[model samples]
Target chain A: MTATLSRIELMRGLVGMLRDEAVVAGIGNTNFDLYAAGHRSQNFYMLGSMGLAFPIALGVALAQPRRRVIGIEGDGSLLMNLGCLATIAMVAPANLTLVVMDNGVYEITGGQPTASAQRCDFVEVARATGIAHSAWAQDTSDFVRLVQAALERTGPSLIGARIERGPAIAQPPRDPAQIRDRFMQAMGSRKGFGA
Target chain B: MPSDSAWAGVVLAALRKHDVRLAVYVPDKVLIPLIDGVHADPFFTAFTATREEEGVGICAGAWMGGLRSILMMQTSGFGNVPNALASLAVAYQIPVVMLVSERGSLGEVNVGQVWSSRVVAPVCDALGIPHQTIERLEDLAFVVDRSIVQAHATQTPVVLVLSPLLTGGKVFAA
Candidate 1:
């Protein structure tokens, strides 16, 4: 019940909560962990981009208002574009949920300390930025509860999960085109190479 | 400002004809009329981005989710988002239509804006995105219309650099 659980376990709990919601995973371990949960066509795996998972998820949320969209990013990635928090707040898409994995370090890059390691609170930041449904899940059970509650809510939600560090349990295939096309197909908007 | 920024109207019309419904922009003086035009229209979903990179990411997401979009920023704004362009837009082949209003090449009074104007081509070239500069109203109707189609069809980001001659550039009062 204590906080600082494995990211893969957190991702598994998150993956279990979804019922066809599109997941846009940020680059690095965030993406790899999502793949470890299971390769759902509904997941969009970011390759080289940093700090864009939330922005991309906002786009999908706006595009398909009927379908829920979740953006999963790391603290390092999310901090790269904090301005997006304002944009998400302004738009206030009811179907979007943001999950920021706060590992306090860049786990993929040899555990380099990030601002989160220095006391930056993403939940407080999200709440102050006008996201009314922001919270820190203190443990695996609380993570599920927050995500479940977020799904039932009516506005944009953000969950800051403080996770334990470890190597990615698995990595997604390196094929960007296949990942994109497959996701498009799953979204029911597949256009091959240019349809 | 030009006594008539009739070109903004032309650009607006081209955007409408192309069915680009989502317009994410970082407002600029030269591009304000177009920004206002999109906001005023019911057919478009217009939003302001705090930075150009955020705008690019939004456009990429919109495209993936089946809504055609444009990312509008002035030339200087484009400089702040080359990484987003290279990583998200170009790397993923999202085909975001980036309309940049040129500043440095014209009678630019600000030293800050000059570098972005020159850097766009080489930067875009490095990302393998094809860029074209359009000056004059007569030429835009065709270029704007065709390039948008080409961008979507090819799955590549197309940078249309709008010249000062066309937007009347930005003016500083004496």
Candidate 2:
């Protein structure tokens, strides 16, 4: 029997998968919506920065080659640093997974239209940059399947998971500074081969 | 006399010796030799990014990932990176070492490069990012190593400017 999953459930499943395999160093963003939706992966939340998730993921992947590095990026955030996909393609780190949550707008700053709304195909851009694998998912099941597949594949991969556009969740009480410290501790661990 | 090729080797060695595992670079004529040298080194993972700001972001991420990373670009490209450096690197305390080729300085033929060159140091200063100019091969190792340390210790971007004389007084080969 096919089981349906909610967006929050899919995110939790993905985070659990990432944590189980020690595949993710951190999940970064300015949107609390991602954090509140049950993502337990270490937060590298951009805080004040709008577009830095992808490059940060690239750096982590390159640095910690033995660990799988996944970025939970927003479509709006991804668009701001779109050139990063080409850089990832050039480096071709087998450990990197870029999961872009595409909800069609900048949900955190209010429901504003993103360039993604203008029909810019992030998947095609990933392909054009020579990223060996790219996937698009429209719902929870699709996200789980595509994300699992992308994580298992080698080299740079991009997953554009279509999410519903909505208001961001209430802001968390955790201080951004504390979150940053926790992320650094997670990333600074030396158990990995490259580290 | 140090040929540009020899200087390139020196720079690459310094980076590796310092354990800089990641490098984010934008294509620049003057930086081609050094970039080629970096690409050939297995000890370092090099990324050719589309813009200077993106390189900065990548370097910051690499730093958080426990890799010492440097950003390489031309002086004219600095204008493309202030926001990334300020908002991302400076604000977040992400250390990124930047190796910038001096442009619009003595013997610069490009008018656009000249205009941007004058503001490079001041901009770096304004951002509170430490910087130094390297004009000779003898100065490369020390300056680069020091900058790397400063960047990591301060958790801020540091710029190492390579003057035309240091890079060779001609356009980088195509």
Candidate 3:
């Protein structure tokens, strides 16, 4: 399969397809590219955390079952917490869509080779972990198609996209409180408002 | 059902009163009764997480989506969540209420539990998380209630350390 896709353009496509939805991006390029695409109140940008976007998305999916929640994670970070896939599969929150960007290297940490470089298949991992709606995107178009399907279907889908590794195009705002407040307000989950 | 002291029940009651709908946990011998209670309740979502950090991440996510969540784990599990706490919970300023069962104190026999138990409090402190160790049954409600409120109000995580003295620590048998 042709997996050579641009992470930034892929993020823009995902962002374009979103409306009244919540997205949580992992630390480094996954978040940075999302920020560079365009910042949204529904977008939660992780500043330093790795391997948590999926869990956070699972939580969001559980909290707001009606809202479509998307989690963006990178290959290196995902490997750091592979067991979370099992957790996600166990809970199986149908509103969640996990998008794993596989570039086979730790792009943010000076481009160290990750386990994905050794032929680790994240889609297979997700499938084995009991996420039935898991697949690999052959190209950018396929990635968008899978994301669209995940958004439309009732499932906690895992979409693994192979991308070209490089430096992040931009940086998200470093203020954690601001990020939380904006996301909460946008999702209508702000405290005291009965969201 | 295992513990007749009603301390863990009191903690669960406080969680319910605070509108906590989700309880993400890694099972501990000391927390089994509480976990069982949460599972039996129809109003709550009790999840058995693969790892403690996964529970933290789930709790943080649940909070962002407008759900109040509590994470219950043993002291050893606390050591596994520093990155999740620091990056996701603390960095996002997500208000999480953690119920950690104390170990390595009150005549604890296990050497494995000692190090994590000693450092759990300091770890919370270093992360700017407000924590209180409950050693008495009478202090349960007050600590649980206040910590939940304070955490939500500040949009930060809080810890309620359950002393083995209060929950009648896991009894080792020969």
Ranking by lDDT: 1, 3, 2
Q: Measured against the native two-chain assembly using Cα atoms, what DockQ does each of the candidate structures obtain, in the order listed?
A: 0.78, 0.64, 0.80
Question: lDDT for every model?
Answer: 0.88, 0.72, 0.88
User: In terms of TM-score, which candidate is stronger, 1 or 3?
Assistant: 1
lDDT tens digits, residue span B21-130, model 1: 99999999988889999999999999998888888888888888888998899888988888888777877778999999998875787888887678898898888898
Task: Give the per-residue lDDT digits (tens) of candidate 1, residues A1-195.
Answer: 237877888899999878888999999999999999878999999987689899999999899899999999999999899989999999999899999998899888899999988778988899999998898898889999999888888889999888888888789888777788888777877746555
Candidate 2 lDDT, A49-145, residue by residue in tens: 5566777777767767877777767778778877778778887888888877776677766778888877787888899989868867666767778
Candidate with maximal lDDT: 1
TM-score of each: 0.97, 0.86, 0.96
CAPRI tier for the interface of model 1: medium
Better of 1 and 2 by DockQ: 1
Going through the candidates in order, the fraction of native interface contacts each one reproduces equals 0.66, 0.73, 0.85
lDDT of 2 by residue, B7-41 (tens): 68778877887888776788787788888877888
Model 3, B30-50: lDDT tens per residue?
888898899999889998888
Clash pairs for candidate 3? none
TM-score winner, 2 or 3: 3
Model 1 segments beyond 4 Å from truth? A191-195
lDDT of 3 by residue, A41-72 (tens): 89988876678888888899999999999999
Reference contact recovery of candidate 2: 0.73
